[model samples]
Target chain A: MIRIGIPRALLYYQYYPMWKTFFQELGAEVVLSSPTTQTMLSSGASRVVADTCLPVKVFCGHVLSLVKECDYIFIPAIRSVQRRVYNCAKFLGLPDMTKAVIPESPPILDIDIDVNKGKRVLYQAIYKLGRHFTWDPLKVRRASIAAWQAHLNYRELMSSHSLTPPQAIEKMLGSSEVEPKTHSSHSTSTQGTIAIIGHPYLLYDEHINHRLIHRLEQAGNKVLTPEMLTTEELESAIVKLVGRAYWTYEEEVVGAGGHYLESRIGGVIGIMAFGCGPDSLMMDVVRRQAARLNTTPFMSLTLEEHTAEAGVVTRLEAFLDMIYRRKRKQVEVCV
Target chain B: MKTYLGIDVGSVTTKFAVLDENNELVTNIYLPTQGKPIEMVQQGLKQIKQQLSNGADICGVATTGSARYLAGVIVGADLVKNEITSQAVAALQYIPQVQTVIEIGGQDSKIIIIRDGIVTDFGMNTVCAAGTGSFLDHQALRLNMNIEELSRRALDSQTPVRIAGRCTVFAESDMVHKQQMGHRTEDILYGLCQALVRNYLNNVGMGKDIQPPIVFQGGVAFNQAIVKALREELNNEIIVPPHHEVMGAIGAALLVHEEMVNSQNGSKFKGFEVSEIKYHTSSFECKACPNLCEIAQLSINGQVLAQWGGRCDLWERSQSR
Candidate 1:
């Protein structure tokens, strides 16, 4: 069986279920690069230019790791996941960037996921991807349907439950008797909730964000994230904006940020990667909205490869304390 | 009289401040850390005890700065806060109407923006020390002059030369080149100051909505040349509050006062007796995986006190601290 390597960065959290199911249906063994590490970050940082965001640098390292293991490495050139919205420029240029940086890597299988050129273009891209493994078009169609269903189910599972993408993926992949990994939830805790708005790559990548969700939970505050909301809710939260945001993934973060502003949550925290253009724009929008409402406390953390854990922890603890003190002051005013 | 003590164990200095129950500064001390934070803190503790009158009630204690965690466990702080929050609180205490705080320490510089008496936004310098006090200190050393002399000499310059200060490495070479180009030392000093201010505004203070009534604190506030450059760059009068060098300790003290008043708890202060406790810190490389994380272990004599700095907390959990 042909081994298909997938770098565990960027679109890995978004389309892993679909790709894994599709390749497994076609009898190809799927190999995922391990969770990010300091070594990987250093290697990635050394290879790429200084200004590349932490996630992309991490992506380079993951690709480099998978090169020696698998026959073919997968790093999709994702332009758009939905109509009228484009991914970051880096995402669109990912395939070419990989080739330029790695140079000695195994052959990369590229897929165009843009819906702007219509649905048929997407199908054609998938068909081209399937041709590498088998010559049957009918088999590819069936595999595509299964992949699509797996993606929908995965989305449903994550939205309905407060599961990080990695945890949800694990739940989907595990056998019949195995249970979903227990996320340290705040549902039982009486403390005030904090809504975190960020991409799945930052939220689920524990190494990058320093297990921020778990840190919040341990600080006696409930945590809410963008991944916890369904598509319908996400859309409604974003409808207040004049039009769809230019960046696709950031629209979801802004929408969730909007929702959290009107929510009973004590604060709003945004974890953005350092030097992310789309996030900076989206975060500015969220900051303006939060400023206008002036109810929920807002904190924005820019995480890079060298962002110290102590610094993050200190800020988080201080923010939590500020919220707690503000809540108490509010109670005092009421009484 | 009741007292609240705050200790700020910074990268380059250790500071201690005691505040009365009425939120008045009683006494404060500043000493060089010199790569021995624990000893400096202990010496500071001993000095503070001697200064205070007998029967002064110690209400609460707080720790702030980079080494706050270790200090908290050592001195048994009632509260531990980030330097940003501590400094903001201290700034607000000094200048109630202050909207902006520009703090430059030894190795770090931070900008804090306040709105209606709350820290709305803040930014810290990342990957660069050009905008901080140590950068100037290093330059002063290279010029065979003390930091205070550098500041005084800089004030004598009529026409200041511009030194590139985007980075420490770049700024040093640029300074050397300017020296070879027949520029006066005082002129170059002012140029260095201006360069640092420019780098700070462009980097740490970028895109920040900097309002007036700005209060500049931290160790670098003592450098009049940098302050002059900052005032000229912003075109506003910069107020350097009294006790600016030890504002972090003052802030931590003020925070402890508030926390004690609200929580109404007895202080966990290890007392001035902490000076007797011999603290030792050592590091070992964890051979887990390819990433060899250097885990630091703090011990009190033969007993392991705390373990920190590993990606995984397997060793952190190994010790109670």
Candidate 2:
């Protein structure tokens, strides 16, 4: 069977299930690099220039992680899902960038997805991969369709049950399809709440964020995340709070923040990967909204591989203390 | 009476300060950057307006930090300066006899050696987190200790555990190992502080003559453990100012004050109403060369204000009409 390597960055968090199902349906083996590490980061940093953002450096690290382990590494060039709503420019140049960083040339399968121009969708991207693997086009098409349907059904079932994408996939496929659960959530109280707002990939990846949910729970605070809310609810929250529509992913976070505010929560924690453009934009809007509402204290946590635990804890404690003091003052005024 | 304003628009935070004719800090505001520094500055200005005395003559304004260029454009600043010069100026203002300045911020860190109030040499570590405030914050979270309590706790330690502070991963793994080996929490915390201080001294503070009367400022100056560790490591007392975190803004404000006194320049500040303005950014790859530099263009009301991220000056030279 052909071995395909996936660098564990970027869309890997969103599309890993789809990729795995499609490749597996075609009788190929899928390999993913280990979670990001300092060695990997330093190596990747040296390979790229200083001007490149941290995410690009991380993407390079992920690519280097898979250099010696797999036959062909997959780096997709995604221009945009639709016109005027494009991914960062770095996503469009991943293949070339990875090649520039890697000392030895590894065979790279360049997958181009230009949905805006109506060039190809997810199925077509998989079909092209099937053709590259020397499989019959008709057989590949049928397998791709089955895999796509399975993926869609899996997502729907997961969302309906308020489960994570991986959880839903596992439930649909049973024991054989099980992947390690990287994130764990626990809530202590419905009244005292904090929202973990950020990209799904960063929030779900336990290794990258280092058990943030557990830490919050250990501190005796309840944590609410974006994945728990319905798509429409999230959208309406964003519209109501922001007074304008936003990009899809950012809308979810804005809506979550809105929900947190409306709930009269103690605080809202904005967690973002370092150098995330959309998160950067959302954080500003959220801060302004939080300030205007004055309902809850707000804090932002930016995570990179270099994130130090001491700084995060200090900020969290200070934020919690601020919230506690504000709540106490409100109580005293009421009394 | 003349009043001056200085703005420091960092990637993670934005600071603003107003100074009177005597260069005394009238008021200061520090806000999380939220990636919309221009908007934050406007919000800060509005807040400052509510506090300023009526009929106060504005002398001049200065902008600094990573977003200095953008801020300079937004506020119509009289002077634009880098963080190094701005920081040195603030240090000199507070500690005239200061020979060394160590500044640790959210995302980066810097060390400056000043000779007679002039910056003779300096080094900045922006590429990594080893010497930055965020690194210490992350470690505190892992240990489940309050960040503010970390410094005080370190001062109580009788034995300091040794942690590899070269990078986050090694530090974390080494910390776990030390904990497994049954080291006291306070000792481990103190060790981590020492490791970070050592790392800073070796890296950003490398190859510089760090002399006495050291002035420590920036966000991390609040960490007493770091101060203690530095004092113990270097065997010298470190001076942290009363307004440590807002020094960059203070320095920028002082610079504006100096400019107004010497140059007779009117303040170019855009005033408090700038919060209502809408700002947008658009990006395009320049095909002028094979470099294919992705250029980000910032605009307000359809007029281009600034452009950045280009390798050469090609996009900057283009008329945005």
Candidate 3:
């Protein structure tokens, strides 16, 4: 059986289960790097120069984690699904960057998922992988189709239930879900709810945000994110809210924010990194729309090396307090 | 007496400071770049112009940061310095005896070790998000707290939870686990502060002899919790000036002062009206070599001002003149 390694970064949050299922069906063992860590980050940091972005550095760390353990490491180059909607330059050059950074040349399975460039679709990308592994095209096609169907069904189920991709995979697989279950009592009624809008890379990555999600949960506030909504719902929400086309990820966030806004969510939180070209432009549009929806308080947080937690916490507390007071006044009026 | 203006257009924030003949700060503004640095600079200039004292003569201007070239063009600056020099100068001004300067911004962090008022060694962590101000900001949002309160909450903590500070993923999982284990929010927050300090010390502060008289500046310096954390971690008292956040701009302004006073040369400051000028950028991937360098060129009114991102100096020299 051919053994493959997948570093746990980038699209790993979205596509890990699908990749794992496909490889398993094909009788291949997939070795994944452990959840991102400092050791991994340091290893990657040492390997690359300082100018690379945080995501790329983390990706490099993941790649380094898999270098010695697996026969071949899979690093896909995804350009764009459509024209004018391209992935970040980092994603497009990931494979080449990895090869350049890693001194010991490990065999990389370079798969291009550039639908806009007329390269490969989801089925074709997997089918090509199947061909690379085995000469039997019929078997490869059958297995690929089955795997693709399973992935699609899985995504559909997740969308239907408004579950995150990981949550959906766990619900289907019934095992191997690493996330700890939240107890009902721990879900204390939040004084206010805040929507954290950002790409999964920035949202889920703890080092990037310094464990922001957990902190929010600990603060006893409901933290809503884009992953909790379906792509269609998110897209529709973005249209309803912004009335403008946005980058795919930004659209999901904006759409989710729209839903939150309509739900009269207490506060809106927009989280983004410094030097993020796309977010820099998209966030302004989101903020303006959020401002018009005055029923809910809104704050846009831009993170950079000089970001101070004190100021952020103050803003959040004030936002929550304002919501609490508003809710209290509304109750008083009703009474 | 002529006044000089210095603008530091960082990725996350744009800073502007005006200096008199003595290079003292007459006025300063620290504004969010919001990704439209050109617009921000223009806005900042307009605001500064309104605030300028009567009879203040505008002489020369300087621009610095990742978008220095563009900012320079917008402000019609005479000097453009990297963050290192600007920061160094700023640190020197606040504490002339300062041996080390730790500047952490929203997106990146740096450690500058100074020797006898000269920068001898420096390390920058631009690639990682672990030790950045933005990371803390994200965490603050997660805590549903304003950033200003983080330091107080951290100070109030009795027990600091042990969070994995190395990577964002592990830190998150660790935080979740700690929360499940019933750790106090304050404790968890303090633990995060420690974790961040640890990551910074391990990554950027690695292998460097950090001497005393350390000046900590940048927007993150405003976080007292981090300042305390750094003090505890380093086992040394850290100095934070009154204008810690706007040090870069202040430093740039001081440099302009030094240049003018030392050389006896006149200032080259274009007036505030230069902010109205239009600037445009165009990028083309150079296939001349396998490097496939995507050279991005910045121009004003069809005249090329600066070009960067090329691997070699091929395009740089051609655009220099």
Candidate 4:
């Protein structure tokens, strides 16, 4: 069986089940690199540019981890997830960056996921990828439809169950039992809810965000994220800024942030990469919207290779304490 | 007599405070950390023991500051909280109507915005030593005077010269240029204070709703010149509370008091004998891979307590219990 490697980094949470089902249907064994670890992070950092945000560096590390394990490392050039609004430069040039950095890398299988040219162009790209395994056109079409169904199911599971991207992926892969992975639920303050708005990569990468949702939950506060809400809810939250958002992730974060603000969740934490372009602009929009809300406490955490866990914990505790006190005060006032 | 103990182990200083059952201050100790947080905390415990004796039994203990987790493990704290919350809590206790808090420690500075006795917003300086107490300390050393004398000299300035305070490196050069241009030492010192205040406002205090009844607390609160500079900058009356140097410790104690009251179980405090428990820290360079992460292990009596501070993480972060 020809083993095709997939690094569990950027777009992995968003597109993995689709990619996995596509290749598996085409009779290729799909091998995913293990969940990100400290080894991968340091290795990735040593290979990437100094100013690159943490997720990109982590992606570099993931590629390196797959160099010796598989026949071809699949790093598709994802230019556009939707029409008009293209991916950041990092995603567009990931395959090239991987090749330039890791001289001893494996043969890379690339497919341009650009729908800007139309639906035929997208099918052509998928056909080219399928031809690497088999020359049958009908087989490729069947695999493509299956992959699309799988991707749709993956997204549906997330919203219906309020599962994080990782949890939903785990359930789909049957790597874990199809059960909701719950954290501390015995908190004294049910009103102290926190909405953590960030990209799937940052939100799910334990090595990147350091299990931030877990930390918040364990600290006697309930946690919420952008992926938990439906598209209609998220869109309605940021209807005021319809044409302003350009990036897909930015829209999700800013819209979710707007919802959390109006919902008056105890707090809204906007996690962004230190040097990310879209996230920085998105965070500014979220901050401005939060400022007007005034009822909810807002915090923006910038993640980098140099981020200190102690410092992050300190800020999180302070934010939680503040919100907790405010909620308690409101309760007292009602009495 | 029941007492609550609070220890704040910062990067530059270690502080301990004791509170009576009524939440009134009993005694406090402040000492330079000197990169030895464990020893400083133990030493602080010893001093507190001498001051209070065994007559007043410590019922609950809490830890705060940068080394809060470490101190919590060492002292067997009932509660462990971050410095920002601790500082805000202490300030609220000191001044009931305080709307803002300006906290400047040696290596860090933060501004906390409060409304109706609750913290609304906060901003912390990111990796900048400028406008912090350490920069002023460095400048004072260059002037060949102690911090107290420098504060006194700055207060005596008739005409303060303007100096840029965005970066410590730039601020030092600007001060030298002013000195070369025949500006008086007192004027230049006060000017540096004003510049630091300006930097604080621009960096840490920016975009926040800063209002009156601002309480300035931290180790740097003792500097009358900085307080005066803050007053002139904000054009609001700045009140420096008593025992400001150990406000983080005081806040921790206050929090522990609340915890002890709420809990049905007895406190987790390990007792005053922990002051004599010597801690041992061992470090070894691991060249396992190209990363070469040097792991440090902290222990008491040759038993590993916790491991941290590596180029890479050999340090598995366990869930906080």
Candidate 5:
């Protein structure tokens, strides 16, 4: 069987299950690059311009690590997910960038997954991807249907259990008979509710985010993320925040931010790459909305290549201190 | 005569404050950190021990600032708090009605927006040291003058020239250009101060409601020119409270005092002889994972007291076990 390599970065957290299912049904053995590390990040950073965001650098690193391990590397150019809303430019040019930078890389299986190009183009792209493994059109159609079902199941598992993508992915991919642990219900806990708004790449990449979700959970604070909300809920929140969604991924930051700010969460944190253009604009909108609301505390944490954990720790600790103290004061007033 | 000891180990300075049971500062010591946190902390402790009154007994101990963990382990602190909370706590103690706090330290600066004795919002300088005291200190060194003289000379300016304060390198070149263009030295110095103030307001104090009674503290409060620039820009009186330089230490001391009072436990202080304990510090790269975390270790007399800095708490947990 021809082994296909997948870089576990960027859209991997969002669409990995579907990609794995689609490729497996086509009879290709799917191989994944290891989780990110210091060496991976440094190697990736060397391959790209200094101004490129950290996520892109990480993606480059993942691609480099997969050089000798697979027959074909899969990289899809996802330009737009909705009718008019568009992804950042980096996503549109990822395949070309990887090919240009890594001259010794394996043959890349490239696909353009732009929804704005209409249903025919989308299906044609899927068919072309499947045709590489099998000549039967019926098999291709079956694989696509299986991929869609897997994606829906992935989304369902995340929202129902209030799990991050990695958590949900682990359960579905891990032992079949083992029951997944249910997260402590957020509704019962009134205090220490923190909403972390960021892209999945930034939120789930333990190396990039410094294990942010684990740290919060360890500290006994109930954490919330954009993935836990339904598509309709996020869409309405985005409309309420900025009239309409401009960026394809704006729902992660702006929509979730607007909804959380209105809710009675203790605080809201916006995490983003240092120079991401879309994130900068979306985060600013959230920050301003937070200021207008003035009911919940908001803080923005910018991640870069710097490995100094002291700065991030200090900020997180102080933000938590502020929340706990405020909650304590409210309790005192009630008594 | 029970007192609480608070130590703030920052990037540029190490401070020690001894506060009595009534939250009154009995003695405080401030000195340049000079990149040797352990040595500076020891020296500050020695000085504080000498200055403290004879009858004062240390009832609690706390640590704050960037190197707080190291200092906490060394001093056997009862509390370890972030500088933001410590600064706010001290500000609230100094003036209960304080709505804003602008703390400009050696390497970084932060703005805290407080309402009804709670921190509502806060922001810190990100990846830039342009609007901090160290920048002023560097300019003073370049001009062959002390930091105190820079402030005095800046106060004498009649018409200040505008220097670009967006980047420290550009700001240095801008200062040189202004000086070559026959601008008075005092005018250039004051211009640099205004530029830093503008950068602070733009970067660290962005998109927040900054209200008065605004109490400005930290090492930068010593510079009258920066204080004046802040006042001019905000069109409100910027109050620099007494003991501004030692406010972080005071806040830590105050927090520990509260903790000790509630718990009814004796202080965890290791005594003033920690200055003579011959402490040793070292670091090693952990090979447990591909992250290669550089873990820092602190020991005394060949006995490891604590280890930290790893992404995972493997070493930390092992030490505890």
Candidate 6:
């Protein structure tokens, strides 16, 4: 069986289920890279230029880890997921970047995905990708349908139950009984809700973020993420905040940010990679919206490869203290 | 005779404050951290112990600052709070109507927005220390002048030259260029202050509202030039409360006082004799995972008292066992 490698970084959180299902249905075994760690991040950081965003660096690291484990590495150049709504340039050049950085790696399976080119081009690209493993077009069609179903189901699980992508993916692939592992002490003592608005990669990668969601959960505060919000809700929020959304993942940052700020949540924290152009602009929009609203408290955390966890801990602790204090004051007034 | 003790162990300085039963300041001690937090904490404790009246009982203790966790473990604190909360609490206590707090410590600067005694929003400098007290200290050392002289000289400037403050490296070069250009020492010093204020406002105070009655505190509060620059930029009065340098410790002390009264628990303070406990700390690379986290251990007489710094809390939890 042809073993296909998938680096569990970048759009892995968004498209892993579909990719895994599609490859498996094509009779190819899918191998995922190991979870991120300090060594992996450092190696990835070393492979790329110093100024590249952290997620891309992490992607390089993941790709490097998979060189010995699989026959071919799948790297897609995803330009735009919506008409006129584009991805970051780094993502557009991802396949070429990986090929350039690690010339000794296995043969790469590359594809260009641009929704702005229309639906037929997108389907044709997937079909061409499928031709590598199988000759039958009917088999390819069936596999694509199955992949679509898996993707929809994965997204539904995330939105319906407020599960992080990894958690939802685990539940979908394993047993539905898989529950989000929460600390025993915090299982029943949720004091407030905190909305963390950021890209799915930054929000779910425990290593890069210093286990941000786990830390918040351990502190007895419920966490909400962009994955947990619906597309309509996010789109409507974007419309309300800036009259439109232009970035591909604007829904995750600006839309979720504007919506969360207007809601009764205790606070909103925006996390962004240090050199991500799209995130910097979108996060700024959220920050400005938070400032204008003056209702939900906002804090922005910039993630870099070499940032110490101590800085993140201090900010989180202080932000939580602010939230709890404000909640207590509100309780006092009501009483 | 009951008192609450607050210890703030920062990157550049460690401070200790003792508050009487009525929240009145009884005694305070400030000393440079000198790149040795444990020694500075012990030294500050020793100084504060000597200054306090014999019968003043330390009934509660709290710790705050970057090294709050380490200090809490060493001193047996009842609360370990972040510097932001401590600063805000202290600011609110000093000026009841304070709406904003601009605190520039040794290696960090923060702007806190408070409304109705609640911290509604706050920001800390991210991955940069260009406008902090350390930069000023660095420049002072380069110019062969003490920090006090730097402050006094900055006040005497009539025309200040603009220096780029976005990066400390650039700022130093700009200062050197201005000096060679024969600009007066006072004008150059005040220019650096103005540049730092601009950096602080643009970075830490980016999107937050800065309404007056603003309170400024922290080690950098002692710089009259920075305060004057802040006043000019905001066109609002910047209030520097009494004991601004030790406000974090005072705030920690105030928090512990409130906590002890409400919880009805005996103080967890290890006592002033904590100065003589003969504590030591060491770190090792943790090989339990690929992350290779550097774990720190605190010990007394070769017995491990606490452990921390591992990405996983394995060593930290093992200490309790």
Write the residue-wise lDDT of candidate 5 on B104-192 in tens digits.
99999999999999999888887789999889999999999999999999999999999999998999999999889999999999999
Q: Quote the positional error of residue A137 for candidate 3 in Å.
A: 51
lDDT (CA) for every model shown? 0.86, 0.74, 0.74, 0.85, 0.90, 0.90
How many clashes in candidate 4?
0
Tell me how candidate 4 scores on lDDT: 0.85
Model 6 quality (TM-score): 0.97
> Which is the leading candidate under DockQ?
6
lDDT, model 5 = 0.90
lDDT top scorer: 6
What lDDT does candidate 1 reach at residue A141? 92
Q: Can you give the TM-score per candidate against the true fold?
A: 0.90, 0.50, 0.49, 0.91, 0.97, 0.97
What is the C-alpha lDDT profile of model 4 across A5-94, one tens digit per residue? 999888887889999999999999887887677789899999987888889888888898898899998999988876777678888888
**Two-chain DockQ for model 2:** 0.02
lDDT of 5 at A48: 90
Model 5 residue pairs with clashes: none
| Candidate 1: stretches off by over 4 Å | A46-52, A67-69, A96-107, A175-190, A232-242, A262-264, A291-293, B173-184, B261-264, B288-290, B318-321
Give the lowest summed-lDDT range of ten residues in model 2 chain A. A182-191
> For residues A44-159, could you state the per-residue lDDT of candidate 3 as single tens digits?
76887677666677788889888889888888887765555656777888888889889674798887777664544655776788776677777777676676787787767765
Q: Kindly report which residue stretches of model 6 are placed more than 4 angstroms away from their true locations once superposed.
A: A175-185, B318-321
- The residue-level lDDT of candidate 4 at B222 comes to 92
Structure candidate 1, residue pairs in collision: none
User: Model 4's CAPRI class?
Assistant: acceptable
